[model samples]
Target chain A: MDKKIAMVDDDTDLLNIYKPVLEKAGYIIKTAFDSSEGLKLYKEFKPDVIFVDLSMEHFDSGFVLCHRIKSLPEAKKSKVIIMTSAGHETGIRFSTDTEEEKNWIKADDYLEKPISPRDLVQYLNEKIFKEK
Target chain B: MKIENGKILVVDDEKGMREGIRRILEIQGHKVDTTDSGALGIQKGIATEYDIYFIDLKMPDIEGTQVLREIKLMYPEAICVIVTAYASIDTAVETTRMGAYQYIPKPFEPDELQILVHRALERRWYILEARRLREEQAKHLLEVAHEQSRMRTIINALDDGILIINQEGQAVLFNPGFLKLLDINQEISIGEPVLEILPTALRDQIKEIFSGKGSVNAIKQEITIHPPAKLVVMANTTPVMGKKGELLGVVSVLRDISELKKIDIIRSQFVDMAAHELKSPLTAVQGYLELVVDKTLGDEPDLYDSYLKRSLDRTKSLVNLINDLLNITRLEAGKVRRELNRQNIKELIIDRLNFFKNDISERALKVNVDIDSNLCVDADRDDLLRLFTQIIANAVRYNKPNGQVNITGRQNTHYVKIDFQDTGLGIKKEEQDRLFEDFFRAKNEFTRNITGTGLGLTIAKKIVDAYAGKIKVESEYQKGSTFSVYLPFAKQNNFTIKNSP
Candidate 1:
């Protein structure tokens, strides 16, 4: 079966650009424009991997949504990735490398924005598929 | 030792006794005058303020006691010694009690007369010296009092709050600023304990200082006080030391840094928002361009056409955002060079409407204009054009199909009012207040697809403000929004059109 992925971002243009590229890599991708819709989409689709933007209607909406997803009993095996534009813009680094950071951020991994689709697929394969 | 010479007067009924006393006193470097009659002696004594007077107990015209009384009344500090032939203890004691320096015997030796003259001169010197010292002390006291009041006036005039507390933590001195900063309405008298009155954070810091646990160096802290109103102050408390290098008290200077703190918060928020806004377009442009460059969708040139078109649109918006940012910075920094001109409001509005003609027709927006022909304002032509362009573009862009955009201008005595009314999706009631803030956009289901830098109204408001004008908005959530701008009328017949070079 093809890998199911969920992506959430406020910018519709970015979602449109990335959706076709990711689907071409043989992944079934679902997208939402905001955190509430993203959460609702997560429950119904139960995608194997989730990508969340660090900011949406509110600055910390992605963190809140990720925490909600991690707290759900059904989200145990699903890997969550938080996409951050803030690291480049604000000079603040967000990472889930340490166990403490993973527990606090409730994210399996993080990626800086302006990420290329080629690198994104490679990162996913290395971290998610190879680990299994 | 240099002898301080004395002037002496001797009054005696016997001529031999008077001459004899004069001879003896004159040899002691004293100038002595003698008279046989008591009335002559009184006249001579009164004329010259002699340091000592030698008056016989039994005189002819005026009695010795009478001469003594008259001289003492004229010069209270005068030293008068009585010389009597009888030498009775009664007469000697009576003359002494009546302001006489001392009494001399009639059969006295030359040494006795000389010694008496020297002692009386010494006594006179001491009285004058004491009087001089008293005058100097009174003058010194007045100067000290004047200096203290001058210091008090200086402290009261300062804008920063100043508080001086004693080692016991009681307020010894405070200025009016202190009361204003701390929001203390009631009068605080000297020696009032101020530990309870201070905010908890500051009180704890002060307590640590008093306990000798805190650093002896000045403790600089930012403290917040809230109750009647929120206030933030930078409290710089230092230990006031004595001459012996011991702590006398603490002096805290509280500067109202609330304004600075507010500006700091706003600056950071603006930076964060600018970063986010700037990154979004770049991300989209990069993603679209990468797909075209890599030819991710299998070797067809036609497949990349749509991506390139979208990338162009994103790049255009990025340029627009940068221009808006620069305009705002220039406006805020007062660096915009403006050329004054008398601009007809009606003509300017029509020109701006022409610029938006394409967008208006594309959306099928109906444009209406009602303005007075002679209505004019004193403004830079380019600034006025930009201001009208922003509002007119918003009316067309935000309007629905077949929507109406009505532009009206009216002139009163001092101002010409221009109103832009659009039949479009208006702002929410809660979001209306934030409409003029930098980078604020009305993001909703309807406005989600609207392409704007979100700085149109902000720039429009700034341009209007530069002309000492006002901008107001009235909106209903689903109905529409009307933005009214009021500009002061240009002076009549003094119109000078100057263009920027």
Candidate 2:
């Protein structure tokens, strides 16, 4: 069976562009246009890997949705990746030391947008699809 | 009482006695007045401020003892002497009890009389000088107290928070500004330890300062107190050295710079957002062009054409974004020279309506114009034309099919107002506040398909503001939105034209 992945973002154009790029790399894809639908789909599909935009539906809603998934026992092994165009300026380093960094962005990995197709597939193979 | 010469009053039934007393006092450089009768003596005593009085017991109108008693009761400082011929031990004791200075026999000694007058004048001088010294001391004390109070008022009125600590690291003085800045409400007094009086973070700094480990100059920091509210402060701490070079205490002056820090953060965020915004379209253009050139569309004419079109569109949007950025920077930097002219607002609206005729007709938007032909606004012609073009274009672009756009103009004292009302995608109440902010656009289903650089309203607002005017919006989500601009009226015959440099 093909591994399942879900993407949540408010930007439809970017989502459309990303959908084929990820699916061409041989993975089943599901998408939600907003945070509410994203949460609904996350519970129903329970995808192995989730791609969430940082400010989807509302500011920092991606962090909120990721926290919900990570707190669930069933979703513990799922790879949650946070993507942002704003992170280009913020320089967000994923470290678990500080409480602020942990609470707001506790994800398995992070990606900055305008991500090349080649880099996206390689990052996915290494971070999510490696052990499986 | 006179210090150089004393004034004296003499009362006696014998004319010789009165003359003799007056001569003795006058020769001693004293001003002496005489009244033989006790009645006249009482009147003279009430009228004059005599320093000394000589009274006789044989007076017809009043006895010497009675006269002495009355004079003493009136002016307690008056020195009175009893010079009576009937003087005896009993008489002397009685007169002394009635407030007489001393007794003189019938054959009075000149030296004795002279000595008695001198003694009376000396006592008056001492009493007057003592009173003057006492008053001078009180005035000096009052002046010192007033000066200290004024100093205390000035210290408390300062805007910067000030904290003074003793050599033992105890808080000796804290101003109201200090308490307000720290948000501390408890009473702080002298000898309170720094840790007890200040926040823990500040206490650590103070401890470092006293121990000679902190910065010798001012230390600046941005701190968030109470979990959410952030404050930036510049604190200058210096040791107060005594005259003998002993360390007295530390003085800390705290100035709030949170507003300045906030502006810096906003400016940086604006720069980042602008860069990202510019990169987004460029990335899409690059990707599409690369796809077309690399023949990734599989040599299908339609696919190639579509990709090429998308690339061109993105390229166009990129150009528009750069233009908007340049416009905003030029506007903010005040580098754009304005050509002031008297512009007919009604004609301007008609011209814009004709300019956006295709978009308006495509959207089936009805145009309604209600304005006076002579309504004029003071503005830069090109800028005003651009301003109206943006507004009417937005009206046509954001309108629903078969929508109506009403352009109304009216003039009031000192100003002309032009309103653009569109039955289109209105903004949310919360989002409308930041609609004119740089790079802000309403993110919703309605605006998803609407093509905009999000800088139209920002530029429009900038233009209106440059004219020393105001722009405001009223909106109801999904119903309609109205954007109104108010501009100053130009005076007749004061028009001038120039190109933007």
Candidate 3:
């Protein structure tokens, strides 16, 4: 069975650009435009990996979505990643490397924007297939 | 010391006696005026105010004692000597009791008259010296009083609060500004303890100074007073030192910095928002370019065409964002050099609408304009163009397919009112108040596909404000929005167009 993935962002172009590239790598992908839509998609698709943009309808939309997803019984098997351009935008870097940060952010990992397709695939493989 | 050149008046009925005294006194460098009649002597004595007066015991016109009494009444400090051949102890004692300095018996030698004149002049010098010292002291006291009052006036007129406390922590002096800044409405007595009246933070700072725990140099602290109103103040307390290097008191100057603090917070927030707005587009552009460069999708060039096109679109929007940022910066910094002209509002709207011809056609949006041909506003050409472009751009950009945009202009006695009504996705009621704030954009399902820097309305509002105009909006969710701009009519406005050199 193929590993399933979900991407949520307000930028339609970004989703379009990344979807084909990720699909070419043999992973099934689904996309949503906002937090609520992303949450609804997560429930229906139950994807193995989720990529959420930090700023969508709101700046902290990803954080709220991540917390909602982590609260669900099905979320334990899924890995959630929060993507942000905040490091470039505000000069403030965020990380979920520590247990406290991971718990508070309710995210499995974090990535900065302008992320290349190859790097994103590699990060996903390391977090998903390598651990298994 | 003897004062030799005394001004002397001799009032004697005896010609020989008067002449003899004048000759002796004149030789001693004294200015002598001898009057034969006692009445004329009194007149001369009072007019000249001679330092010393010599009167005979008897006179025909007025008694010599009468002259003495009259001179003493007018010039109380005057030195008077009685010279009479009928001098006896009773008469001598009587004249001496009536402000007479001394008595010289008549039929005396020239030496006796010289000795009497010398002693009387010495006494006259002492009286004049004492009077001069008293006058000098009074004038000095008056100048000191004036200086103190001037200092008080200056302190009271200052906008910054001032408080001077004694070493005992008592409020020795305070100004009206002090009371207002501290929000103290009660009558503060001169010797009131300052710690009780001051806010806790400032009171603690003063206590630290009095306790000698901190450096004695001026301690500057930012403190907030919260009660009736929130006030931020910069309190600079320095020890007032005396000549002996003793701490006399402390002088605290409290300046209200609340406005500056608020501006500082706003400026930082604006910077953060602007940075975030800029970065979002850059991220997309960079990602698209990177995907093209890496050929992430495949080896086919056609696959990258759409990505490149999107990148180009993002770059164009980035450029627009930068331009908007610069325009806002210039507008807010008051650096826009205005070229004022009487511009017809209807004509301007028509011209601006032409810029959106392609968008209007592409979206199938109908634009109907019914504006008065002669309605005009006195404003900078570029400012009005930018203002119109922003509002019109929003009407077209946010409108649904086959939407209708209605623009109308009318004039009143003072203002020219122009309205741009668009069948567009209107703002939520809760978000309406923040519509004109910097980088504040409505984030909802309707606005999801809209690409904007969110600075258009902010810049529009700023430009309108610069022209002393007002811009407001009336809208209902999912229906449409009407943006009304009220600018003063060119002819009715009091704006003076400064001629450029």
Who wins the lDDT comparison? 3
Return the top candidate by TM-score. 3
Candidate 1, residue A79: the lDDT equals 83
**How much lDDT does each candidate structure score?**
0.83, 0.77, 0.86
lDDT tens readout by residue for model 1, A1-132: 789999998778888888988898888999988888989999999999999988765456788889899989999879888997763333223334457656767787778888887788887778777757
How accurate locally is residue B117 in candidate 3, as Cα lDDT from 0 to 100?
Answer: 80
- Model 3 error, position B201 (Å): 6.6
Instruction: Assess the local accuracy of residue A111 in candidate 2 as a C-alpha lDDT between 0 and 100.
Output: 76
Ranking by DockQ: 3, 1, 2
Q: Estimate each model's TM-score.
A: 0.66, 0.61, 0.81
lDDT of 2 at A8: 85
Looking at model 2, residue B456 earns an lDDT score of: 90
For candidate 3, the per-residue lDDT at B290 reads 77
Clashing pairs in 3: none
DockQ for each model: 0.32, 0.20, 0.37
DockQ of 3: 0.37
Stretches of candidate 3 exceeding 4 Å from the true structure: A58-64, A70-73, A86-119, A127-130, B1-50, B53-57, B82-85, B104-122, B149-217, B224-231, B239-251, B334-340, B492-501
* C-alpha-based local distance difference test score of model 2: 0.77
